[model samples]
Target: MKAGSWSRLAAACLWLATAGCSARRSEPISKAELLTDKPSERGRVVFMEHCNRCHPGGEAGLGPALNHKPLPNFVKRYMVRRGIGSMPAFPQQLINDSDLKDLMSYLTALKRHERGADQTALEEINSRR
Candidate 1:
C-alpha cells in the first residue's frame, strides 16, 4: 500500500476510536422527560444542576451510586446537609428544605424505576426458560 494510503487509514482509525468513545457518554436528560410530576420534575432539574456532575443518572461517577444505596431518607438528607467523605455539604442556602424534599422524591422514583427494569428483565429471562 502507498505511504499516503497508510497514513489516511491510521487517521480514519483514530477518528473512529474517538467517535466511539464520545458516543458511549450518556446524554443529558431532556426537559420534556423532566415534566413528569411537579415536585419530581423540579427535583430532576435540581439534580441536573447540582448532583449530575458526580452522580450521572444516579449511577456512580465521581461519587457512589445513589440509586441503589439503601440509605434512609433522613440519612441521605443529613449527608446532603452535612457532607460525607468526598461528597460536599449542601447547606440550606444551596438547597432549601422544599428542594431537598423534591430531590428525595426524584431519587426514590429513580430507584424504583431501576428496580422495575431489573425485575422486568429477570422475568423475561425466566419466561424464556
Candidate 2:
C-alpha cells in the first residue's frame, strides 16, 4: 500500500482501538455527521449517505458492500472513477480525491477492526475451556 493509505489505515486503527471500547459501537452512525464532522470522519459518512443505499456495510445489496473483504486502493479508485457494469462512475466533481482516500481508509480500518473483534471473541471462547 502507498504511504497515504498506510496513514489513513493507521488513523482508522487508532479509531477502532478507541471507538470500539464504547457502547456507541452498538449505536447507529448517521450520514449527516459524515459531512459535518472533522475531516477524518468524512469517508464513512460520505459512503453511508451516497453508497450505503446500494451497498450497506460492504455487504451485497443493490450493489456490493465494500467491506466484504480487502480491496486494492487503485481498484477502488478505478471503479469509482470509471464505473463497472451496472454501477455508475463517480467523477471528481461528486467525490474529490481526498474523500476517496478517506473512503478507502475507512473500509480498510473497518475490516481490521472486524478481524480484531473476531479474534478477541475466539480467544474468549477458547479460554472458557
Candidate 3:
C-alpha cells in the first residue's frame, strides 16, 4: 500500500484497538447505599448477608470480634461502607442504606450490653473485695 494509505490504515487500527480496550470498568461503590440511621436493624441484616460469611455474630470468626471494638458511629459507618483491612467492599446495591444503619445500631447495642455485663462483674468483684 502507498505511504498515505498505510498511515490511514494504521490510524484506523489504532482507533479500533483503543475502542476495544474496555473502558467499562467497575464504578466506585457509593456510601449512600449503606444504612446510617439510628438503631440499624436493617443494617444488621445487611451485615449478616455480607459479613456473616466471614465474621461470626457477636463473636469473632473469619474476621475479628467486631463487638469487642467499641467503635463510634462514623467509624462503624465508614468501615461498613468502605470496608477495612481484610473486609470486602459492599456497594450500595449489596447493602442498602437502611441495612447499614441497622447493622451499626445492632453492633453498638451488642457492645453496650457487653459493657454493662463487664460493669456488673466489676461491681461484684469490688463487693467481694
Candidate 1's displacement at residue 43, Å, is 0.5
- Please provide, for model 2 over 1-129, each residue's C-alpha lDDT reduced to its tens digit, 9 standing for 90 to 100: 975566456544543554333111111321112122344367788777667787766555796445533456776787778676577888989889999888777666554445444455566679998
> Model 2 off-target regions past 4 Å?
1-40, 116-129
- Residue by residue across 74-129, what tens digits does model 3's lDDT show? 66676666665567767788777777777777776555444344455556679998
Pairs that collide in candidate 1 are none
Q: Which residues of candidate 3, in runs, are more than 4 Å off?
A: 1-41, 115-129
Pick out the ten consecutive residues of candidate 3 with the lowest summed lDDT.
23-32
Stretches off by above 4 angstroms in model 1 are 1-35, 119-129
Residue 60 of model 3, lDDT score:
57
Candidate 1 achieves a global lDDT of 0.67
Ranking by TM-score: 1, 2, 3
Ranked by lDDT, top first: 1, 2, 3
lDDT value, residue 102 of candidate 2 = 85
**What is the per-residue lDDT of model 1 for residues 1-88, given as tens digits with 9 covering 90 to 100?**
9754554465445435543111111223211222247888889888898899998887767976676555567767877886766778
For candidate 3, the per-residue lDDT at 112 reads: 46
Q: List the residue pairs that clash in candidate 2.
A: 58-65, 58-66, 58-67, 59-65
